[model samples]
Target: MNQQFEHDDDIEPASKSQLKRESEELQALGEKLIPLDRKQLESLNLPDKLFEALLEAKRLKAHGAIARHKQFIGKLMRQVDPAPIHALLDKLAGVSDTHNAWLHGLERQRDRLLNDPKALEALIGEHPDLDVQQLRQLIRNAQKEKASLGTPKPLPMKAYRELFKLLKQFNPEPPIPGVLRSDDDDFDADE
Candidate 1:
């Protein structure tokens, strides 16, 4: 007569202790895929701007901020070699984010304004030169420049450039500022 024994499939499931050990092994394997050190990333010798983009992406990732992470990832793809990080970014892009609201500062501001109609109207009334689209643009500009709404004046071009870079990450085909009709032809002003 054959002796009864536990079949492999019928074996008792792994305990939490055993499962934790397995998870640690898997995590080690995952760690081998990418270097976690900031210096190693810097050594990639990516273009200065692209490097900045990557660092920004990393910052967002570290903070669990998905939107900025995606924005910088997309910008990296467009502005730099799309080979190394595309696969990783593609996987992330497919995973929908519930907390992407803070990714774009302008978006956050717009939401606040839109939700409060009085605020929206007040902003519109104050900036009469601003159309709806311009209003959106200014918000973005303000965010990028780190200027507050209560600021006495619009931000400088350098500040705008910071925000523009952020915007271009999401919208690769953004509009270019036109040449201003000014008397000083020698001056290359950004407006």
Candidate 2:
């Protein structure tokens, strides 16, 4: 009976290598958090002390200091339950993907408008709120800028950019369901 009890006690815990890998994984997750803007980082709802430490890490210029701060963040991360953080990050990633798809749709619409006159009529039919005359003028200028094929002058992107802005005004992406959007979503509006 004593021997059986001793054998039960001898069942080993996770090995040192496994522990090290877990620590490294946590550190890598912390690294990913570094590049997020202030509002997005705030949305993670991190513990206040840990959040301050991360902000400090962002300000650290020296390579050694940044590395040390990252290790400290990894240590802090181990103390918190990371499931909620993971969920928020995943939700934010999905929002980013949706925003990119919307931008691509706008780009395709702009190209169609520039290439085909009938595309303008189709757009106005679909989005009656858009000003047909303004769209026509912008399309004409964009086409003229594109035609500088044999000149030494560089292509002017002003009209192309203006068309994108106008399209955004006409149709904006609907908010993602159940997700609190961060202000950083507008960071790429100009692009």
- What 10-residue stretch in candidate 1 is worst by lDDT? 173-182
Q: Judging by lDDT against the true structure, name the best candidate.
A: 2
Per-residue alpha-carbon lDDT of candidate 1 for residues 47-102, written as tens digits (9 for 90 to 100): 67655655554444554565545544444444444333333322224321221322
Q: What is the TM-score of each candidate against the true structure?
A: 0.22, 0.63
Off by over 4 Å in 1: 1-35, 61-65, 82-191
lDDT of 1 at 141: 58
> Per-residue error at 37 for model 2, in Å?
3.4
After superposition, the stretches of candidate 2 with alpha carbons farther than 4 Å from their true spots are 1-16, 43-49, 60-68, 78-100, 169-180, 183-186, 189-191
Candidate 2 lDDT, 1-191, residue by residue in tens? 99999998899899999999999988888877887777766766778988888888889999999999999999888876665566556555655666678888999999999998898999899898887788889998888887874679957878888998888877776554443455454444456
Could you give the C-alpha RMSD of every candidate to the true structure, in order shown?
Answer: 18.7, 5.9
lDDT of every model, 2 decimals: 0.43, 0.78
